[model samples]
Target chain A: MAPQGQVTSVPDDGLTTRQRRNRPLVIVHTGEMKGKSTAAFGLALRGWNQGWPIGVFQFVKSARWKVGEENALRALGEVHERTGQGAPVDWFKMGSGWSWTQRGPLDDHAAAAAEGWERIKADLAAQTYGLLVLDEFTYVIEWGWVDVEDVVATLAARPGFQHVVITGRRAHPRLVAAADLVVEMTKVKHPMDAGQKGQRGIEW
Target chain B: MAPQGQVTSVPDDGLTTRQRRNRPLVIVHTGEMKGKSTAAFGLALRGWNQGWPIGVFQFVKSARWKVGEENALRALGEVHERTGQGAPVDWFKMGSGWSWTQRGPLDDHAAAAAEGWERIKADLAAQTYGLLVLDEFTYVIEWGWVDVEDVVATLAARPGFQHVVITGRRAHPRLVAAADLVVEMTKVKHPMDAGQKGQRGIEW
Candidate 1:
């Protein structure tokens, strides 16, 4: 066990501390828990504190859904820009409407997601952000809007000091295999089992 | 699938939206994933945005360890106080001395942890904050420094609209049972598996 209550056994990563610091990270947050995206946002927040520009791309959620993280991060970015203390944060989303809706026509959804992926791909090639949050990106691969192999290869070959954090449930095994860090959030209990809907501040 | 990517099957909590809005929550963050503590901090940030007071209690890691989250949260609390945005945040840690070294004398460790838990218990009873982060509280129970049953009962019986967030790996089962929400972070892959140690910005 680690110094804390950690029960999981971590295998040897087999790298020098220097190598670990310099190497870019590909992190996957999957499983059936509530904090995958939130964790990624927290990470982005951390990176923002370090003055690393952040690029957040949402694959499944629509443009209408206003997540609190987006607002908070953007405000942080503004603070950084005005005072040169933190980092800049950019947000983007896909889908036709709110995530609750039908994605605004199934056919259009696929095309829109594809276009979004293309833009992110271009940005990745250009090393747009130090930290790139692919929020809910697994759905695109799961829904066949993007190929898993292509994503795996693209991320593996992405240039510069960029870090990509992907969040979603049921991440493809191949993607997991490529990740330097993969966390599967398991659900033990939830109020939603009792039929409580999502709230504005807490849920969003 | 939830309206979002939430996978937890929350059962009928027998709470109306208003009741839930008013009721304090017991949120447990467990499992082997690296982001357990990070996620809890993220949740705290979310609560901070709502003008909720944040109280963080660390059961492991010395008070000396300078976590990036602590600094960021402290800064955020400052911003909130100055600009009438976000919320206030307080951070505390326990260990023998500072964070980097041993747990002082092994014999005094348990007593120290118990003392720390006592303070947190008092705070919970008083509803000192809207969001109470029992960061790494699981270890105390795992090490027998504190009684899990007592902790669970106290949490279940906590009064007022206080949200408690507990984080660590190998959480006690009874604690999970009493929790309204539990997230188990499963580590699929880690840089530690390759022998790379924790990084400054990413790990802390």
Candidate 2:
């Protein structure tokens, strides 16, 4: 967190500073606390400022829920289109036609999650985005909807300079191992702990 | 982090859910890791989307450091000006003419920090912003440049619906006690631990 951006340790990875700096990263935001997805979206904001194309795929949350980041980031995309200031942004969520195939039950969240993973795999293969945010993706892995090994391997071998950030609670060990940076958002205190209900603007 | 935004516990405070939900919050982001400020800026993005005017005050970091959020948020302000979207944004940092009233040494950071805090007090009293981000302000409090008791008292008794978010490592105990929500960004694993250098787009 230093202003100079100091590295804590220099590895024997044999890569030059520039090479190490430019290397693509896999970041994981996990733990049972708030700000996991929020921090990932904040990174997307930073990536957007760098003119990096951002792709956000919400694995768990339904499209019906109107999160504030969705509107703000989509608005930023419009600004990019109009003023050519930031880069383009794409947002996708589950329960929004991922059930088009109608495989078995209408509440087949597992199947829908698998479909989302396939899309992410395709995007990774195509190198379609500079930053790919898999918001709440750990749930899919935790629920056995998606294979953690597959997710980690695909991200490790992802082509180009695509940086992927996964956010959710109880992240798989393999995913954490594969991540370059991992932050566990720990709750010291929450309004909910004091019996306060979540607000529209603040929580959403 | 539920889609339904369910409260873990309901208080017996006699307030309706609507009133409790409408209450303003004081959030503190503290720990020995990255994304403290980034998560705060993410909240600012949500606030801006809610049409809440945002005021950012940088306490420790100098004005010369070009962080990405500053540009993105300022661009968002421009978008608001052009298209009548979001809300107004204002950003301030230290070492940028708070020295104009120096009474002692040229490197009197304590005086500068105190002056920066005075402006915040004035803004809070005037109810100038719906969201005020005191970025890295905890450092000043940690260094005893500003009194923590005064800060807690002022924020606890601040007028109107102003929500304040303070971000830094090692937040004061009194401030944390006063906050409605507190998140400690714990580092599970860092690229720096493996000797990876910080990158331009990723770090800043």
Candidate 3:
């Protein structure tokens, strides 16, 4: 496959690999297909393996979703704590519940989204993690819970060598514009498209 | 955050979650975007946590490119072999080198691809792994070395409840049609677009 080059008004700076590694980046993953969060989680796993502090902040995922990547990452954290080799990690779910009846039980998705965004902002300010995954965060912009400009500004001005990864579909134009790296997942075929339901262990 | 149901004509089977767990799956990650192999590695890690045997077949990755995930997974494999916990893993890079100067270095990319496919087929027939990741397999099909139809048929009939994940770009249509799941990554921005090459422990 061939990905088109970066598109938009703000262009990426011509930084060498060493300089680039030292610079913080805002990476975005938005798409209509699966793997956005999965890919982001993969990146987090890579970062953790490199001994970088990692943080995963889920904005709108169902609280009960309990993804397999989450379990694996948490296990990695435990392994690190037990043996001083893995990266320190943290995972947070600010979204509501899963289940057919209790889907997003929160009365105000907007408020919850705002709260999630605010906390992430604080983390960015403190540069608490070298690699921070804002899992499913595009939902906040998609649902109008957070302003795109604020996100772009915050990410643009974030301190330290922190690398932030945002994941979800329908990322705002401004967010895409501000990102240093962006990936849009396009679906070609999926099991559910064939009437298959999500499976455990693999799905969660 | 949420994947809308499948949109293609291939409807997923009405397999119960338990049944799905018991059935083998053929998943593909293809596109121009980054993370195709990364996501596949993450899945392997999750499966390893569940004590499933994992195998990674690298078809066309540069011989010198030893990804961080490989290191991490191999370490996990070592841990398992010593303590009898995590899943056993085997990593193979069959297809020759990368670079215009040393492309394949084997005179015949097609023959090398075929040989690689043949070995994987033997492994599948032997049910050598529960979670087999055919990393960069699409390159073989893309290069017309192996028949997509044959590849698809082999996976469709593979033995055991083994899950196979093929990752690369430009997946063939027949391959996509035969896949249980497919993700096409679209690049919005890349570090290389900014003249920043892949960094050690990050891109590799």
Candidate 4:
């Protein structure tokens, strides 16, 4: 019941509009020792270039000197430099160097580390970051240092504006299910089995 | 103290020897929107060629026809054709069809269309994939259909050998905390806001 040239359309019920505005939660699961950290660093660099505040966390308890982590942090620093944001110090590096827990009980050490992690988490939550990487966060849960439920509850309650990333080997299944997206990494080949040590800058 | 020249020599500890056996997880979080889905597709394609099993999941309740998913599935089909590994019908034309919660009371029609997500999740956790992608999963949570905790738990419990990726905007902090890498997509300049309708094969 309209003119020949009239374009008939449905009324604008706010449904579609609301859906369009709803943002989602994204989670990437990179498997163990598969350069997931490096890829994460690349994403962080991209986010920083766009002027987003960023934070990085490591949860592995092994306390070994990881070249990959070092390199990722270094790259982030360089990205910041290029963007004229004064170099962001590598807090992990500056902190008490990796403390290998190969000996006796790690009760005290883990407790202290958990405190540090909480502080970092607080800073991350307070800032308006576009991207925040919790490298090896699964280890915190895996090691039973932090309560997984508490972590999940806190994250779920956050504002929709911030993005966070948790990474580590043996991530909790609950964490994966709760995420908006999940990715796993598999390894098919490597050069280290050939009796070669990790090359300085390249491997790191 | 022993003689300087005869000092007990330390073993290499085999850290380097075992390096080859360790496969690191490589996760690439491009962002929530924009080109992330395509970037993930490219990475999955590369991994699939190496004989890696790739899992794809779309969390957005509403399924719009997407050429990217179609093209990626086609590429996968080609791989199956060459490898004689019967093409997985699920790979090609994969999607959930429509938002899980589209206003109005839950109708039988909508419930019927929402079942595909479960199948997709099952495939991801089946342990057959080298890389798994959960696309637009953020919407699932945003729409309040899937419990974020369940998703996170499932993903975390996945075997250590698989690489996983979750993509969408406004990801939960818990998922980010559990992820090895997280990338947030900030909309700097998008053509859609300029009154450009999505183009087939390009925007999809």
Candidate 5:
């Protein structure tokens, strides 16, 4: 029923245009104590299964010892074993310069944290991974330790194939505008206020 | 040099104690689009202002549409206008669902659309919302329409002080999980892929 010179053949099997062009950048806004880090861990595990290289960046106020980050790393190990993707890369923790235990001016400590953010920026610029997770990086901006504009620029400049996931509370409107996906984890209730201290395997 | 046994009476802030005692329930997940109804909208906005009468339940497929909810509702003046509250009451969305126009079975439509999750759960219980925002309720649970235990339980058993949010993607999960808030919307993506088209403002 086609014209004499018209080509009426369908494209080859197992390939589609949408799949070829679908590259996503996800932003997750985890409100206070709603397990944003845990969700990131789940995504990392899934990415590892697909043989995607991943980078983890933790930028928070006074990062000393967070059990959630540790659990995420341990989960990465399990993912590695399941997928045979070799060992997972260790996370880079960019602290707020001053230790939580020591309460002082912390000018020098703040400088170190700034340097760590630079390192993260550089890694993102280099485009070294299929997925990158920026954990609690929003707090750095909130505390005036990092420039939100610079972060936005870096994300905008990323290569098309790279997928970036940023997590934190109180994300800026600018960041939300730049993101392809955003999830805000609002906390309705928490157990800590009811005379219950942070419990292992739950709060951590 | 204070006098012995001089009792410094502390003013009892009743808000904190009440908040702790009530302990609002929160449910977070991904579901179909455009499933949450006006009831969910009213509760989320009103309960947030009152304090301690809030819950966030999202049932969307991917974590993409949350920003859309914020923008649309805020533009429509649904969200509370003031500040200084300990935490804001707002509905959050999560997840990406399948494209409707794709060449799939029509049987997947209801599940993909999340038809019944929002109303059945949120409205039936009637107690879950001081405020509720069901971000995406339909599409997430479209595959299994008949089996929705969690939805029933949550709707049937939620506490009086709780507000609910229900977004639509697939309602199967939502139906089993119960919702005090429900929303549903048609989806239209950017740049308009072949066989896909969208109007300005409506799609965005």
Candidate 6:
């Protein structure tokens, strides 16, 4: 309700205003509503505008599923490459495929999810992306594929200025507690409530 | 929570599934949290991927305020113009001045807000864009600069397949009632709570 970028309270974290303000954020988007992943992608767009390298990791969504954000952002990445305007972008889906694994597509969701977390751990350590979006990652935590404590610890101690945004429903309490910004997307109304199927371009 | 594009129920509105699914939506993002405008901009990116023209109208934010979304989207617009990959994008900020008004930056806030609403009304009636983003528009209604009834009625009567998304906090009840998809962004945590100022690349 306050204007954008207004701080309400200040904690005694032994850091200066500049240090606190410039600290890389861990943002979590959770709840049983829409716009969780969409908003995460939106944040990636902002990061892209800032010439930040972006990495999108989809956990629940299938690799075959082509969302509009992928196309647009990929195109933006291409634009960045061509004109040297923005930064690079990388998108990886952890449903059937793991980019690091030699296997083509895994049948085991749990194994795929675990491997995905391992890759994320390596990326966090390397500080591969300025903005890393873990789309639908909460499900893996809720499903117990990845340890919440590990995630919290890894994110808390991530190297460099990497901003991590995790999105999905039923986010673990520990993850929420560790996050710098947590947004719960509550459904007030939805077309599906009226039995309407998802529309093209709107839903995808 | 359901997979993207999966419908939970079927309505008996006498329309086929395709027709029902393809219906344009009025999405409202409200509540006292971040990512409302961010999510709307994400939707606009999706619309742009579908080759739908996007028009962004910023109501409360000043023209001097240079958000990152504007830069990325405008670049995408240029990409569309050159390669014809995506649709065109137009951004209007109604704070210091109105595009239609010949007069320079107005000193009056109420008059500026009123004129901004008038321009949106005209655009809605004309069906100028496929996706119209009314960014931070809820404040106009809450401030009594624009009538909520007029807004709902105008949006309800909008012709063609235009999808309108309004983003802001404390949305009027009637506006929510008229919206097809309403997302209330509830804040669980924020960096600002710890007295952190907004960061570059992340906040802008």
Candidate 6 per-residue C-alpha lDDT over B92-163 given as tens digits, one digit per residue, 9 for 90 to 100: 888658667788887778889889888888988888899999988999999998999999999989887899
**For candidate 1, what is the DockQ-based docking class?**
acceptable
Give me the displacement of residue B128 in model 2, in angstroms: 0.9
The complex in candidate 6 yields a DockQ of: 0.68
Instruction: Give me the displacement of residue B53 in model 2, in angstroms.
Output: 0.3
Query: Candidate 2's error at A95, in angstroms?
Result: 0.9
The numbered model that scores best in TM-score is: 6
Per-residue alpha-carbon lDDT of model 3 for B95-146, expressed as tens digits? 4532222354565667767777887889899988889988888878888889
User: Between candidates 2 and 5, which one is better according to TM-score?
Assistant: 2
Q: A75-144, model 3: which lDDT tens digit per residue?
A: 6776678787758888877745212123555567787778778878888899788899888788789888
The candidate maximizing lDDT is 6
Higher-scoring candidate on lDDT, 1 or 5? 1
Give one digit per residue, the lDDT tens place, for model 2 in A46-164.
89988899999887755334367888888888889988988999988786544334444336788788988998899899988999999889999999999999998899889778999
lDDT of 4 by residue, A15-48 (tens): 4533334332445554644445544554444444
Interface RMSD of 4: 13.7
The fraction of reference interface contacts (C-alpha pairs within 8 A across chains A and B) present in each candidate is 0.54, 0.74, 0.56, 0.00, 0.00, 0.83
Task: Tell me which residue pairs clash in candidate 6.
Answer: none
Predict model 1's lDDT versus the native: 0.79
Model 4 lDDT per residue over B29-92, tens place: 4343454564455445344434456666654434454443443344344536554442332342
Ranking by TM-score: 6, 2, 1, 3, 5, 4
Native-vs-model 6 lDDT?
0.87
Whole-model Cα lDDT of every candidate shown, in order: 0.79, 0.86, 0.76, 0.51, 0.48, 0.87
Q: Rank the candidates by lDDT, best first.
A: 6, 2, 1, 3, 4, 5
Q: On lDDT, who's better, 1 or 4?
A: 1
Q: What digit string (tens of lDDT, one per residue) describes model 1 on residues A15-117?
A: 5546646678999999887899888887876787766789988887554344567666766776776677677788877765323235464457787777777
Q: Over 4 Å off in model 5, which ranges?
A: A1-20, A24-26, A30-33, A61-69, A72-83, A96-109, A192-195, B1-204
lDDT score at residue A72, model 4, on the 0-100 scale:
33
lDDT string for model 5 (A64-107, tens) is 34444444344444445555542454465544332322444435
